[model samples]
Target: MLKSLVVMAVSFLLSTAAVAERLKDISTVAGVRSNQLVGYGLVVGLDGTGDKTTFTSATFRNMLNNFGVAIPPNIDPSSKNIAAVAIHTDLPPFAKPGQVIDVTVSTLGDAKSLRGGSLIMSPLKGADGQIYAVAQGNLVVSGFGVEGADGSRLSLNVPSVGRIPGGATVERTVPNAFAQGDSLVLNLNHPDFTTVRRVSETINSLLGPNMAKAVDATSVRVRAPRDPSQRVSFLSVLENLEVQPAQEVAKVIINSRTGTIIIGQNVRVSPVAITHGGMTVAINENIDVNQPNPLAQGETVITPRTGIEVDEGSGHMFEFAPGASLQEIVESVNQVGAAPGDLMAILEALRQAGALKAELVVI
Candidate 1:
């Protein structure tokens, strides 16, 4: 039979003709990226589901003092319908003043929920300690929770966090440094030496000899005109050039939280023997009442008893032929009626034995 193999990252793999993509799709120009902005703010106008912590009261009084309101020093402002929240958003590159951006608000106090809350004016700051945007708007919460007096609570989604669509206004702009150097650098999103070499050769072939050079696995330097107007046109042409990148490394990713295993098509296995078994122990509790002998002047007492049962399964053993493909491995394992839990253990054992020819990543 023919060798069975699959390309890892099939979802991202394109058709043969479509594999040639715009250079911009795989790489970004150096000095062109987004910055993170964060702010601390207060959320108001909630429907009785708000923070009652002492810090919340102090924050309320501080806000009042800033607005020229004087209160008795001992008066603890116990506002029941206001909450403190942390606001955060990404400031896109070349963002100009007056541009709007969406923001996320997360509760910082004992607020029950952030539903139907409006944020107060908060100045968003960048890493350089400069205020770049101002965020203020009504929060949109898609989840809610309800609790009964008996402490029975049902939650649909996260209620302590919310989002505001286009709520922040940019106050400043982050300058771009694209036109400074005679040569521009391209940074690949997925760094590969083969891809870098291909990109360099493609550019040199079209523009001229030595027009591009692979400085590192991730960075490629290309000669270009230094004039601002000409540089823009040069990049426009450079990003449009189609090039094929290298295939990704074969990997098997497992999510322990969800017990999901994803095996890449390129994944292979050497000859290996695997045994899948299960052992279970169950403990049951029972309560019994002991009564004093008739009129013996003794109180009745309750006694507890536990019963434990153990079942050790003799697992099935299977062997994989050398160079077996991922599909075949899964099929063989399934034919033996091995459960997901058992499959996880078998894969790990194969990896430890060096029979698995792929990276095993657990998350």
Candidate 2:
């Protein structure tokens, strides 16, 4: 009874571990991706906050003409509740006819907000200029507001941009050569030679030898059944097979515009000393009026005096041992009281001095 219970516990643990992660999260099958779709249309029913551009009038007129409502050419109707907008959505791989996809609508004209507005019928097209889907729906806008009487407005989220869930209907399918070859290639999102070899080995171990080959660091070619139905099943099995990927390379990414710094876990710093300090200056001005003593005739005079004071800040010093890791780097910098800006300068200096053992990218 004791042995049977131990075997049952082990089996349960193994069964639960088999479905750790879905293959779609780690690897992407080539030719299986989403294509961007875009279109131009108008959003109507605004509360007197629509665009006043002449192009909006022309577009409105064109729409009327299509509906057999002919207006005199001399008259231009400018409605304050209609805005010209652009629509965008993604066409997923293997999308079929009559399937709906979500879409985003953004103002192309000077519309204050698109809240409570409805998008008109618009044909979404691909890069080849062929209409693939049509989008039309009421917009769900968030956080758009009009300013005060002086045109000073405060908003948290953009109201001029909105989204419609399941708005566009797919009219045609995009062509893909997914089933043209006997083998399929799996591309890793991040290229690593070690990861590629491991992926190929794992697949071969399951589906027999020579079933998968690493073409390069970024791509792994796998043989599959010639029949399309069997190929789908084979992929379904291969994707679910778990394989551990290699560690990420050491690197640092900096956002110069935002003053943000991101240091990788694998980054290392050699032995170095860092010193940071701050300085502040203060200025003061004083004016004095001199009047003749009671009766002494003397013209009133004013004298101005200026005083300047400077405070030189004290700096703290910190040292790192050879090959210190990320946590050590952060603690070392913080120990010296370095601000974000000061830390940025120190990181660049370290990279230039060749003491950093990782790639430093300033974006």
Candidate 3:
């Protein structure tokens, strides 16, 4: 009877662990991804926002040279309205020749803005220096700037860059192919034993009995059909199969610059007393000019005055009993009138005091 109870308890614990996650969300086939492609190009048709030839003479000269024309020996290229730019885009996986993709154009020279400009025929190359796509389209500037005779102008975030949706045509295809061998590999975005086992079990149940098995926390190997077409169809079905991903253990992330704080839903805080206080000092300077009476031969003198002040407000300490949850922690913090920023500091302090149960990450 005692032995039966022990077996039952162990079985229950194992069953709880097995149901954590299914499969699809945790793993993906290896060697399937997007590729980055970049190139240098020029944008024309700007309303006087193009690069001055003196600053970007090479770009202007090259552009004219592309059209089978040369600058007169004494002519200045800056007089021409043109802009030198760099174009960037990501070639999605399986992109074919003649397909269109959006491109981003950024000024590489001293051009003030790219508004109302048209990008010339630009060949975008990858790291291999091979042209993968040809980009040429009207530029779309999201911001605008205006200046008056008084040299006063208001500008938005950035006017020097723009994008062209479906602006580039793929002139070449990037070779991306997968072949099936004795086994197929599954790569996990985040590696964990609990997740790997669940994925293996789920695949095996769908395909057959134990056809897929975990090689490690990060990789799983599965058997595939010998025919290429069958393997492709099999993978299509495998990718859509749903698997709930395991949640990360408790953690807190704080961005100090933005004063943004995010805590994982599973984070827990232990009970402890918290008290916060801050000091502010201010200094003011005053200057006064003393003038001589109307006709008197007195010289003017300046007087300097300085004032310093400090403020101290009422402060209180609160106690938190043990076994406190996140809700209780928030309530206790609110009761002490702690602002978000102050609460962030207090949370850090609590972590150091061994009262906070999760890892504290500050960015």
Q: What is the C-alpha RMSD of each candidate to the true structure, in Å?
A: 5.5, 8.3, 9.0
lDDT of 2 at 285: 97
Among residues 3 or more apart in sequence or in different chains, the pairs in candidate 1 whose N, CA or C atoms overlap within 3 Å are none
Say which prediction, candidate 2 or candidate 3, comes out ahead on TM-score: 2
Each prediction's whole-model lDDT (CA): 0.87, 0.85, 0.78
Give per-model TM-scores: 0.83, 0.89, 0.82
Kindly indicate the candidate among 1 and 3 with the higher lDDT: 1
Count clashing residue pairs in model 2: 0
lDDT of model 3 at position 328: 61
In the range 13-33, model 1's lDDT, one tens digit per residue, is: 334424777898999999999
Badly placed stretches (over 4 Å) of model 1 are 1-18, 275-317
Per-residue accuracy of model 2 over 188-233 as CA lDDT, tens digit each? 8889998889888888888889989999999999987778788888
Worst 10 residues of 2 by lDDT: 1-10
- lDDT rank order: 1, 2, 3
By TM-score, the better pick of 1 and 3 is 1
Worst 10 residues of 1 by lDDT: 1-10
lDDT at residue 342 of model 1 (Cα atoms): 65
lDDT of 3 by residue, 105-198 (tens): 9998778889999999989898898999989999999988888899999899789999999999998877754564766788888987877777
What is the C-alpha local distance difference test score of candidate 2? 0.85
